[model samples]
Target chain A: MIIVETKNLSKVYNPDTVPVHALRDVNITIEKGEFTSIVGPSGSGKTTLLNMLGGLDKPTSGEVMVNGEKITGMKDSRLIDFRLKNIGFVFQHYNLIPVFTARENVSFIMLLQNRDKNEMMKRTDALLEQVGLGDRKDARPKEMSGGQQQRVAVARALASEPKFILADEPTANLDSNSAMNLLDIMERMNREEGVTFIFSTHDQRVIDRARRVIKMVDGAIAEDTLISVEAANQ
Target chain B: MKTLLTIAWRNIWRHPARSGVLIAAVVAGLWAGVVTVGVLNGMMDQRLNNLIESELTHIQVHHPEFLDEGYSRLFIEKVDEIAAFLKQDERVKAFTKRTITDGMLQSPVKTSGVRIRGIDSESETRTTNFHTNMMEGEYLDSSIPNAVIIGRTMANEHNMELGHRVVLTFEDVSNQLTSSAFNIVGIFESAGTDFDRRNVFVRSSDISSILYDKAVFHEIAIMLHDEPFAQSLAADINQNFSGITAQTWRELSPELNLIVEFGEVMLYLIMLIIMAALAFGILNTMLMALFERMREIGMLISIGMSRTRVFLMIMLEAIVLTLTGAAAGILLAIFSIRYLSSAGVNLERFAAGIAELGWDHMIYPIMSTPEYVTVVIMVIVITLLASLYPAAKAIRINPLEAAKDS
Candidate 1:
């Protein structure tokens, strides 16, 4: 089933003085459990599209339907609640609260949801192990490597059990080895846990691993491609 | 709520130096405010006690015309009856009759105008605690014929010593001027220099013999066991008695009343000024914290922390910070006040100035519980008010823009 769909979405910045069209009539759909990537050069509206889909930014004129609920005109307070329950976000710099430990960083989203304590702890431990940081649960972000922190961020994004996670340049800050390690964890989670992820990246590694790719040039989609299982494996 | 509190509590310590400075400012401000109020309160209490116990007593009665016009003929007619009633009254702790007359005191070199109080020494001492203030000689010794007690200030000004003789001249009951010679047997000092300089005490027999055909009293001062009963007892005296007017100490000394009333207002004004300064320090610190943590706050909001939660988080941070400082300050102030209350703070260097203003030079600092509670409430109110702009700024952060900027 289509878990997310956007229709005729557009965004304009400073429309009164000097209008900048960040997104122009963009449309996209993602099925449940799909791993997809939107790739483009800088300032090509990749992040804006992700923001629109995640309900982080308002579209100039369009509708965003997630799990058959229209969220385009939702109030800020309600939209935040919707985002919390349905969509997860991973920013370029691993924004794990610097003060929270690895386990606290992972379980913090569940805590915001007011989840049961025992369940939060259990899930946090399991997710940390899944991200291969089970032993570093007590370490704070500052004590961890970039790859480990990003893995923790991914665990945090999944802790909310969102329909889809929007990752903006998840590997941009990592070296080749750390970036591959992060991608391996994310790909494994996508394959085994049926977790859906949509990434905006210039990194070829992430684009290669994605099952589907949508290319944008100058605020509009230039190409959309679906790679077969054989091609993805290759 | 727990998660919010945890985040808020951790957030304040992120910049230890900045938070420490804000906390120190709050501590110093509240300490200074509370201690200053305590000192003023102590001074006011001491002054009030001195006025009531040593000078005004609780209530006083006078012939209706005696206070308005200082005519020697306008004496209370039923002095014996009023004294009898006061002696039997349950509320009256002590009472005394005085024959007061405006006169001139001649000390060989200088003659100054004075209010001479003719009193029975035993009753006067019990009623006004007057004998405790004697600085040099005996109080109203009847054996020394025409003996008088003068204030230290008056004696100093006139360069008179104990055993010196002075002459008092005033109008007699028949409107004829009369003069009597008295020996200065005592020199006493009181809190008020003005009171000391203007008043002289003499034996009732000597002054009355020269001024009246028969014995007459001008003033009846009554000391009560309970000070709160002064007004009601004064009212009762006025209602029960004829031809005499009764006045409470508050009525007799309206300036003291004004000081008591205005002192409370001044206390709050001082607290407000201190709190306002503390508020600015808190506001500045919180604003800086907000600006520095913009992206983190944005992330929290984007992850589903409500705007109200964000606001509460910032507010809690400020409260925690301020309350920590306020607790320390209050403890410090309480300890200091207690110590000073027991040890007393001597203003001997300013004794002359303080005495001129009718206050004792040695003050014992005091602060009541309600005042401390008021200070605590003020701290909370100031913290909430000061955190508004910063908390609002944190909630207004756009997650999208913040994330983009990051």
Candidate 2:
């Protein structure tokens, strides 16, 4: 069953002069449990495409239907509520609030959703352990390694138990080993919890790990490929 | 809300030097506000008290006709009945009846036209500082048929001594010329320069004698236990008596009343300027912080914190800053005012200016409960106003752009 779908979504920036085509005529559909990568070269609108899919940015013209709701036409506030309830985001920079500890960063989304304190704590602790950062929960982003911070960000992204997660270059700042570890952790969550993971990345390692890959050029999809069982099992 | 306050408080301490500078600015603004208000309030209080203690009692009762041309008219009849009525009122602390006449007091060297207040000296001593402030000799002995007490200026001008006789003359109630010889008994000095230079204290009987008629007092003065109660008491007295007017001390001294009025105006003006500075200061700080933390704010919005909550968090920071500053300001004000209250700023050097302004030269820094309470309220108001600019900026902050700031 399709959990997320975008139809002919396009985003245009600086339309009148020196116009930049950020997204153009993008069509994509993701099943309930899938690890997908929107892969492209620099400035190929991969992040913009992911932003559109996650309901973070509305398409200039077209529709983003997530969980059967046309999110593209929703008000900013209702869209925010949709995002909080059905989607989670992990950014390239980890984007943890500098003032909060790793555990607090994970708990912030649930808190904003006005979840009960005990439930929030339980989810935060569970997600932190799932990301293998149970011991580093008290450390601030600045006090943690790039991999540790990214793991905390991922833990935070999962704390709300959203149907899908949007990670924009989740391991772009880490070393090869840390990157591999983060990808492995995300893949494990995708397989075990049936949580769909959508990532935009320029890194080939992320493309290699994705169950499906969509390659983009300029602002439109150039190619879409489905990974066989052989590739996933490898 | 708890998270916002926690983050705001930690953010304040994140850069101790910056916070310190802002806090210092707050402290200085508060101190200046407190001291300015304190000294002005003190001067006003002194002026008010001196006016009440030195001249007008809380209320005065007199025949309505006496208020019109009564100074020169010599219309002192029915004084005993009025005094008896006022004395019976429970709220009346002390009351005095006095005959006042515009007359010429002449000595061998000088003759000055004076407004003579003829009093029963013993009752006046209880109600006013008349006897205590007398600079020489003694108060008029009413039993002495022609005894008088003059002002120090009068004594200095005429070089008169105790037992010296001054000729006091006025018109009789029947509109006939009359005169009397009174022995100089005492001399007094106070804030009233005109009064000291020209006024003479004569027994009521002497004034009656000078008028050559059975006499009554032109006015009655009533003292009260508290200054604030004076106005209400005066109103009650005025309402109860149909043919009389009760004049509170504030009404009697328009010049002194200006000090109180001026203090209120100056306080508001100072608060406005300080609020402007505080708003700018807080906005400048918050904007700088927002500029630097744009990415963080965008990230929070992306994580589903509403734009309204984001704005509220920033506003919370501003409130925290101001409230902290206000706390510092109040402490500084209390400490400084208490200190000023002790050493008391001496404006005696500005004696001429003080005299021209009709304020006492010595200013005792005064803080009434209401005035101090007002400062606290001002601090809160200023802080709330200061938060507006920062909160507006935070609300307008674009989540997409802010998240991309890095």
Candidate 3:
């Protein structure tokens, strides 16, 4: 089923004095359990598109429907609630709260949802183990390595059981081995749990791992290609 | 709410040094405010006590015309009846009658105008404890014939000592000038230099004999067990008596009444000024903390923390910070006031200057419980006001922009 769709989406920065077009009439569809990557160079609207899809920023024009609800013009308070229940985000810099432990960082989204203590603990422990950071649950972000912190971020994104996770250059700060290790865990989760993920990146390895790739140039889509639908099913 | 509070509490300690400095500023501000008000309260209390105990008793009675016209003929009528009533009243601690007349005292070298109070020596002492203030010699001894007691200020000014004789001249009840010779048997000192210089005491029989063959009384002063009952009792006296009027100490001294009323307003004004300063310090600190945590706050917003929750968290942080310091400061002030009250803050070094203003040399600091409660409520209000701008700034942060900036 189509879980996310965008039509004629556009964004303009400083539209009054010195307008800069960040996205122009973008259209895309994302299916359930799909591992899709949007690849582009600097200022090619990859991050802006991800922001629009996550409902973090308002589109200048057109509709972004997530799970059948038009979110482009939703009020900020209502949009925040929608995002909490439907979408999760992982940033390039591993944005786990520094003051919170690895387990607290992962369980924070559940806390925001007001989950029961027993359920939150059970799911938090299971998600941490899936991300391969079960032993590092008590450690803070500052105490963990860059790779470990990023894995905890992924676990946090999944804590809410969102329909899809939007990752913005998730491996941009990791080493080559750590990048591969992160991709391996994400791939396993996508296959085993039928979790959907959409990524915006410039990394060739992430692009290589994606089952479907959409390349963009200068705020508009240049190409859309399906690398392997059979491998994604297995 | 619990998680929000936890976050707020931990956020304050993110920069321990900065938080510590702000807390210290709050402590100092509150401490200074409380101490300054306490000292003023102490001075005002002492001044009121000195007036009530040493001079004006709780209530005073006089002929209706005596206060308006200080003539010797306007002495109170039916003095025996009033004295009899006061003696049987349970509220009356002590009472004294005096024959007062404005007169001139002639020393060996200089002459000065004085108000002569002729009193029954034993009752006068019982009512005002006037003999406790004697600096030298006896207190209006009846055996000495024309004995007199003069204040220290008056004796110093006239260069008179114990046993020196002086002549007093005043108009008699029939409007004739009468003169009498009296020897100074005592010299006393009081807090008020003006009162000391203007007043002298002599035996009632001596002055009454010269004024009229029949006894007369000009004033009746009553000391009550509780001063708060003075107004009601004075009202009762006015309703029951004829040809006489009774006045409480407050009515007799309007200036003291004004001081007592305005002193509370002054205390609040002082507290407001200090709290305003403290509010600025807290505002600056909270704003700085907000700027430093912009990225973290943006992340929280992106993850679905409601704006109301974010606002509550920020406000809670400020309240916690301010109340912690305020609690410490109030405890310190209370203990300090109690200690100094017992020991007395002595100003003997400025005795001459203070005495000239009718104030005692020692003061005991005092603060009521309601005053402390007011201070606490003021601090909370100030903290809320100070936290507003910063919390608004926190919620206005755009998560999209913050994500890119980070």
Candidate 4:
């Protein structure tokens, strides 16, 4: 079943002067528990597509259906509430609050949900162990290595137990080994936890790990391929 | 809300130098505001104290129309009943009746119109610090009907000695012309305006005999044990005496009130200017910080933090900065003012200039507890008002645009 769907999604910038079209009539769907990667070159609108799917930005003309809710036309405050309760995000920079420890960073989204401190600590520790950072729980982002930071970021994304985790260029700033580790960890999470992964990336490693790859050229989708269709079905 | 506050604190220290300058500006503004108000309040207190101790008592009771129209002829008779009533109230520590009249004093060479204040010498002396103001003569002698104490300047003008007699001529309350010869027993100096210079004191019995109404008195001055309760005492006194007016020292000196009020208004305008200028510095610091951390703020927004949270964080930043500065400023102002109050800020060095301007030569700035408290409250209120624009700007920031910023 399709867990996320977009129809005729389009984004325009400065229609009066330059009239730049970032995306045009893009239609896409992702099934439940699928690891989907959208790959594109710079300025090819991959970030915009991810933003639309995550309800962070509204497309000028489109309908975005996530978990049976049309989020594209929702009010901004409602969209924020939806994002807070149902979605998690990972960024290229790892985006850990410098003041917070690794475990604190993981627990931050839970705190946003106003969970009790005892429950937050429990979930934080479990998630840190899940991401293999159990020993470095008290370490701040600056004290951790690039791979460690990215692992903490992934742990933070999963902390809220959201139905979808959207990662935008998650490994664009890491070294080759760090990128590979991050991709491996994400693939493991997708396989084990059944948390849907939607990544916007140009990294071939990430694309390779994805069960299905959506390729974009210019401002339109060039190809959509199911890498392990039989395995994904099972 | 707590999450926003936590993030706000972290954001404030992100740029130590910039945030430090904003804090310093706020501190300076608070210090300026507090110290200026404190010093002015202190000076007004000193002046009011001087007025009460040296001249007007806490409450002055006079005949109904006498106080309103300054008519000495309307002096109330049988004030013993009022005096006895006041003596029963513990708040009234002391009371005295006096006769105030305008007349001309004539010696062989000099002649000037003078204000004669006839007091029950023993009671008036006990009720005030008037004895301390005597220059070269004895105070009023209630036993002698012909003895008087004249101001130092008046004695000088008449070239009179202690043994010299001056002839005083005036119409008594009965509209009968009368003349009495008074010995210049002493010279008194009260550093008031020309009013004090023209005053001559005599015994109340002497004036009562001449006026042919020994039961009459011009004013009944009451001294309160607790000065703060003077207003209530005056109200009570007025209630007791249906037709009479009971006035506190503050009401008698509207000009002084105006002066103090003018200083306060000026200080408020100055504080407003300082607040705006300080806010400019803060706005610069906060906006510069926001501009530098564009990507950071954008990242926070993208991570499901709402714009409202970002706005609240910035406002909290401003409030923290102001409160910290206010704390520092309050401490500094208090320290300096306390030291100054004890040792006193001597205006004697500029005495000649101040005297030429007809102001007091020695000025003691007097800040009370209430004035200091008011300064603190005002600093907080003004600082909060100053933070509005910056906080609003932070809230309206678009994450997409901020993310694109370099």
Best by TM-score: 1
In candidate 4, which residue ranges exceed 4 Å CA deviation? A129-148, A229-234, B62-74, B80-91, B104-113, B135-137, B141-147, B150-196, B206-216, B225-251, B257-273, B335-341, B350-377, B401-405
Whole-model lDDT, model 4: 0.78
TM-score of each: 0.97, 0.90, 0.92, 0.85
**TM-score (chain B) for model 2?**
0.87
Tell me, per candidate, how large a share of the native contacts it keeps: 0.69, 0.57, 0.51, 0.18
* CAPRI verdict (incorrect, acceptable, medium, high) for model 4: acceptable
Candidate 2 local lDDT, A12-114, one digit each (tens): 9988887788988988899999898999898999988888877777778989899888899899888777888898888988888888899988998888888
Between candidates 2 and 4, the one scoring higher on DockQ is 2
Estimate every model's Cα lDDT from 0 to 1.
0.90, 0.80, 0.89, 0.78
Point out the worst 10-residue segment of candidate 4 chain B by lDDT.
B397-406
lDDT of 1 by residue, A1-234 (tens): 899998988899999999999888888889998889999999999998988888888989988899889999999999999988998888888888998999999899898888999999999999999989999999999999999999999999999999989999999999999999889988888889899999999999999999999999888988999998578768
The top-ranked prediction according to lDDT is 1
Per-model DockQ against the true two-chain complex: 0.74, 0.56, 0.62, 0.30
Position A55, candidate 2: lDDT = 74
Ranking by lDDT: 1, 3, 2, 4
lDDT of 1: 0.90
Ten-residue stretch with the least lDDT total in model 2 chain B:
B70-79
Fnat computed for model 1:
0.69
Supply candidate 3's per-residue lDDT for B101: 92
Pitting candidate 1 against candidate 4, the one with the higher DockQ is 1
Report how far residue B188 has shifted in candidate 3, in Å: 2.6
lDDT of 4 by residue, A72-166 (tens): 98987677768877887887777778777898788888887788999999999988888788999999888999889989989988887887988
